[model samples]
Target: MISIENEGKVKHNKSVATKLTPIEYKEITKLVEAGIYLNSSDFVREAIRDKLKAIKVVKIRDVDYEIAKKEVLGYYRSHLEAYISEVAEDLELDLELVIKITNELKKERRLDEV
Candidate 1:
């Protein structure tokens, strides 16, 4: 078991056996030797954390999509204009997902591009 902390929140992780290629193992060992990571486990944990951050999983359903679309339109109504990135950050949505919703709204003549 491993205990990891992020943003003052503690997460407990279970140990799992993972196989690494020779080159991958060597690279991790080199990093560990250079003090970049405390150990191989630390290196692996950090890599997993980075990958998790890079990938976002959103379960999109018609109901959820409709709700998000309404929220986007509501935001545009209050603000004259907003960047896709800004809307995504403010609404706590994935950037690509927000872009998709915005594009659909534009096509439907509900939103205008400025």
Candidate 2:
């Protein structure tokens, strides 16, 4: 549920027939009828705002997810190789523990490349 300025109001949008797909328009109508939004315009505005917010945060267009993923997954992409190489050089010590920590760090820093 959204906190609208006027909860039970149907404020019309002063648009010149913005062409929404039939499914999109129907979904908005259903949400409005179910009281999920103040009105159709509010629903549309919120949807657009949310999408824009996601785009602003994640600049998906300029990002190269595939290249970054390969670079990240590769051994030499980060300083990660230094740690791995150290383990490889000193194979007498059990390296399994360090591998576990490396997996966790990958999950954390992968988003930065994005």
Candidate 3:
């Protein structure tokens, strides 16, 4: 059994066996000695979680970008600032990024009002 401390809570779970190359094993051990990770299993689990979160964020950002692009095109000429602010707030994204994307869309002539 292996235990990991997560958010001040101790979680106990059965350990799964995994084989690591010599270099990888050494890296994990060094990280442990450096106090960067409690153990190899915990480090691997955290790394996997971080990677999955990054993948999810990329997918979500893509969807948000498309939606923002459509919204920008809709209210671009008439209410540019309002629409930009609204999209930024709704998507919980950086305002500058929203503005930059909108500018790019405008420059490409992809956001002409119908």
Candidate 4:
């Protein structure tokens, strides 16, 4: 059984034990000696909290990226013909390239009625 001291009270927790290298142990000891943490356990607990928070942020960012990607793709898929026509008119585009794309869209039945 593992115990964590919370507000002067020790609470038993189902914790897994792991061994750290001598160097890692020394670093935690150094942190405590420097008064950075009350003890190695508190440092480990805070480190775990920080790591979990970082993972949560990354997951949220990935979800946001996926949502943004879907919205952009959907917009392009629904407005491809109009966007192509507008681009060809509004920009100095290569005639050959434009013709090739227009032909491809025609084959795909995506070109608007001229």
Candidate 5:
């Protein structure tokens, strides 16, 4: 399991920012009234943080994909049965599902005919 180091920390900087239009303000009011958040800033910050973390996770995974794929490909070449078992073991995947994915990879020409 890959663990990500969350270096994100909250900074306390109080600065008055821009104003929203009436309709935008009303939508923010609705969100506050919905009892889901304390205020608009809370809502916006949470939304931004969630979106940022999602993008970060994807970026981190993307950085590792090529190397991981290369290792998977190597195992895929040498001993297919062992490779499938290894994938299932490492990912805690179901045997049937792993086999299905392996078959699909072969079908897609991602894996050589063995």
Candidate 6:
């Protein structure tokens, strides 16, 4: 178990065990010694967060793409300027896909180039 302190409150998190290859263990240890991470748990937590972000973009369908495009357009209409990265993060979409949609809008003259 690990105790995390947030906003003057302490929260306890359960510990999970997993097996790693010798090389992987060595690498993690070396990184910790180099101060890349606080410890193995910190590294694992960061890895898990990165994996979750990657997993968020899977098997997007055409309908989903259309919906995202409409959302992007609506957001642009409301905002004075369209920031592609902000739009992607706000909509929880892949940045590349958002850029593609923005480019399409520019090509169609639906959105002005900024």
In order, the Cα lDDT scores of the candidates are 0.85, 0.55, 0.72, 0.60, 0.65, 0.85
**How do the residues 1-114 of candidate 6 rate in per-residue lDDT, one tens digit apiece?**
657687877787777899999999999999999999999989999999899988854443334889989988988888868578878777777778899999999899999987
Please provide, for model 4 over 1-114, each residue's C-alpha lDDT reduced to its tens digit, 9 standing for 90 to 100: 557686887777756577899999999999999999999888888998899888731111223433433433344466654554344333334334445556655676655435
If both were scored by lDDT, which would come out higher, candidate 4 or candidate 6?
6
Whole-structure CA lDDT of model 2: 0.55
TM-score, each model? 0.58, 0.36, 0.42, 0.41, 0.40, 0.46
Error of 2 at 6 (Å): 24
The lowest-lDDT stretch of 10 consecutive residues in candidate 3 is 56-65
The top-ranked prediction according to TM-score is 1
Per-residue accuracy of model 2 over 1-114 as CA lDDT, tens digit each: 334358787655455358889998898899999999999878878878899888732122232444433433453344444654354233322344435434655677642222
Clashing pairs in 2: none
Q: What is the RMSD of candidate 2?
A: 14.9
Residue-by-residue lDDT tens digits, candidate 1, 39-111: 9999988988999999976543334777888888898889879998778777777778789999999999989
List candidate 4 segments past 4 Å from native.
1-12, 57-114
Model 5: per-residue Cα lDDT over 50-104, one tens digit each: 9988873111122244455555556666666565766655544455555676776
What does candidate 6 score on TM?
Answer: 0.46
Query: Backbone collision count in every prediction?
Result: 0, 0, 0, 0, 0, 0
Candidate 5 deviant stretches above 4 angstroms: 1-16, 57-72, 75-114
Per-residue error at 96 for model 5, in Å?
Answer: 28
